[model samples]
Target: MINAQAANPFGEQSKLLETVAAWTLGLLWVLPLLYAIWTAFHPAEFATRFSLTAPLSLQNFVNAWHAAPFPRYFLNTFLLVTMILAAQIVLSTMAAYAFARYQFRGSNLMFMLVLMQLMVMPDILIVENYNTMNLLSLRDTILAIGLPYFASAFGIFLLRQTFKTVPRELDEAATVEGASALQTLWKVYVPLAKPIYLAFGLVSVSTHWNNFLWPLIVTNSVESRPLTVGLQVFSSTDQGVDWSIITAATLMTSAPLLLAFLLFQRQFVQSFMRAGIR
Candidate 1:
């Protein structure tokens, strides 16, 4: 193997270059996180300085928490994410089931329309969505922030693909046992699509949690503003920029998702892998 590698000098050089590029990119991504951690744990005076002897403290976190209405922000974010995820799952499941199992006059056309939606970026419809929200009087509400995302093309597509992989015999057997369409879905398709659901859930949660543009535009009040919007408002020019406190608040903003990912990372990875391989 060593001799073969030595003979393929160009291939070896390409791999070496790729490794270097990967490490460089990884460091670039991680440096800011390291800086945040350092600043969040040390005194403000040490924010720009690196010293092994610097005293570690949680005062920054305390100051950040006291500075903003973080509890309300957290509540808004939780409600927003949960409401969106639940609605997406229900709507996607029913739509995907119909597309995967039953056929109708406009089934193909409808499915094609859904596929077309996948091609259209949500940001492109920001104006239309905003206008609709205003018409519905849902502006500045958590429901308004989640309403546009309730029908997720990506979720429907993923679940449809997963549902299609189930055997026809099982579906027929469930029907023969006097199960209705919804019953069959709950007992058969849903159980089999657990991994897809999990993967989709993670994607939905992460996407909505970090979403900024739509929320910032839609929400104008503290009661409806999510963490991302709240954080942006807090870090704006109106508020004095203290790196230590800002970094602490940033960490606090991201902590729930980060901790959840750390705890379920293995499951998250496995679910995606299963969905992909299927």
Candidate 2:
């Protein structure tokens, strides 16, 4: 009883410390976003000024929208993400299934090679990818932006792990019912790994949607530029920095992803949980 009573104070102190630390970190993380929000909605003079009675207007957003080819950028980003996701899903599913189900010669070596890709940063391969795009005559196109990412090492690794967890009996049963290899994969394995698929799809969409450097290097025109690249070009100018307009533009470009995360946050969490993704 004495020991329990003595530990209670220490435990309370630890919890209090933890609570303070958490709020401190949370505030730090949110400070920039809060500043952006304030700047985006208020006039240029009031951007740095924190006034409770500051007038909010939508003029910044209007000016930002008219200042760039945001509509074309949006279209390009949408098409890029859609193309990359579809290709990744199909290719990753097939590759993962092959690696998980088949025991062929050098299968382990091949899988190791795939995993090696995860260790190497994509930025490191920029020169080679750019050369390949040039050789293929696909530069300054959406295809060039997505070609290097069509086969995702992370997607394959994730799906392989998910597929390995499925029972062998399901595969056998599908085969016994006169299902071909492709049919078995489609019917039995794919449905069981839906959570992983959802998780991967969301990750892929967000990553490609926000990809800037590669797209910036490959695309030269507004028609081929994604939102990230477009926003970058729009923000940098000979004129002085306009925080209100820049923040408004930043918010506009990121609004889709932010909205998606907010709306599907529960499902996103659940999908990652079910997929055992950390």
Candidate 3:
């Protein structure tokens, strides 16, 4: 009884420690976002000062919006993300279907090569991709910004795993109904993998939406510049840093992704769970 009582106290102490650690980590992660929210809403004088009577104003947002071509940047980013996602969905779907269903020679080798790409950082290929874009006379174009990312290795790998989980009986049943291979894939495998598709689409969209370095390197004109690049250039002007306006612009640029996550958070979690993601 004495030993049991001692062990119970130790277990409670461990649990208390874990709770404290979790709260600490959560606060650390949220600190920057909270600071941004504080800065974006208040006037410049109150940006670094936290006061109960601090006046909130939308003037910073207005100024930031008018100081640059944010609308054009938004349009370019939207087009680039949509185009890349569409191309990735089509290419990854077909490649994954072949890798999961076919028995061709060298198929395993090719899949292994695809997997190898996931380990390599994309920034390492920026110079080569830029040179190729120049050769094709596609420099400073939205297409150039998205061309290298159209065929995603991660998307192929993810879809292939989901496709492999599907049963062969379903494929054969579709074939018995006189459906073509494409029809079977669309009718059988695709429907069953909806959760995986949603999960992958979210990932692809978020990655490209926040992608800055390659877009900055590829696009030189306002017509093709994305929000990230535009924001960076706006914040670096000769007038020096204006924290209030910069934070407001940052919030505006990130609001779409934030709203998307907030609205679909439940679906996002459920999709990942159903897809068996760890």
Candidate 4:
């Protein structure tokens, strides 16, 4: 009984340590975001000075918004993300269908090559991709930013997994009803896999919305600069970086996506859960 009591105390201590560790980690991650929020609204002088006494103002946001063509950047980002997601969805779905449903010879080899892209991303081939973009006459265009993401290996893999999880009995039933493969895919598989589609779409939208490197390399002017690229200008001024203004600009750049995720948090979680199940 004394040994049992000692073991119980050790277990309780371990649980207490785990709880403290979890809270510490959570606070560590949340602190930076909280600091950004603080800097975005605080005066320039108070940006680095952590204080509850700082008076919040909307002036920094207004100044940052007017200093750059943020509206244009936001519009460009929206258009680019939409274009990329739309193209990726269509291409990945078709490719996933082929991989999941068909048994063509050498299919495994082709799929392995496709999956290889997820490891060695297009960004890593920036020079070649940029040259290809130039050759296509899409340089300095949103199309250039959206082009490389047109076929997402990750999306194809996710959708293929989801599609395979769909019961073959549905395909057989539709076949017996004289439905073509396309019809069965559209009516049977696609409908059942809506959650995975949503999950993939969310993943695509979030990723492309924040993409900076390729867009920065390809886009020369404000005409094609996405929000992330645009925010860099405010953060990296030659004269001096205005921390408050830069933070405000960063906040403005991320606000739309942040708001969207906040609003759809439940849906996002549910979709991801379904995708994981598949």
In candidate 2, the residue pairs with backbone N, CA or C atoms under 3 Å apart (3 or more residues apart, or in different chains) clash, namely none
Q: List per-prediction Cα lDDT, in the order shown.
A: 0.91, 0.91, 0.91, 0.87
Per-residue lDDT value at 270 in model 4: 89
RMSD (CA, Å), each prediction: 2.3, 2.0, 2.2, 2.6
List TM-score per model, in order: 0.92, 0.93, 0.94, 0.91
Candidate 1 per-residue lDDT, tens place, 7-105, comes to 887997899899999999999999999999999999999999999999999999998898889999999999999999999999999999999998899
Native-referenced Cα lDDT, model 3 = 0.91
In terms of lDDT, the poorest run of 10 residues in model 3 is: 269-278
Clashes of each: 0, 0, 0, 0
- The 10 consecutive residues of candidate 1 with the worst lDDT sum are 231-240
In the range 105-183, model 3's lDDT, one tens digit per residue, is 9999999999999999999999999999999999999999999999999989888988898889988899999999999
lDDT of 3 at 134: 99
**Candidates ranked by TM-score:** 3, 2, 1, 4
Candidate scoring better on TM-score of 1 and 2: 2
Q: What is candidate 4's CA lDDT for residue 218?
A: 94
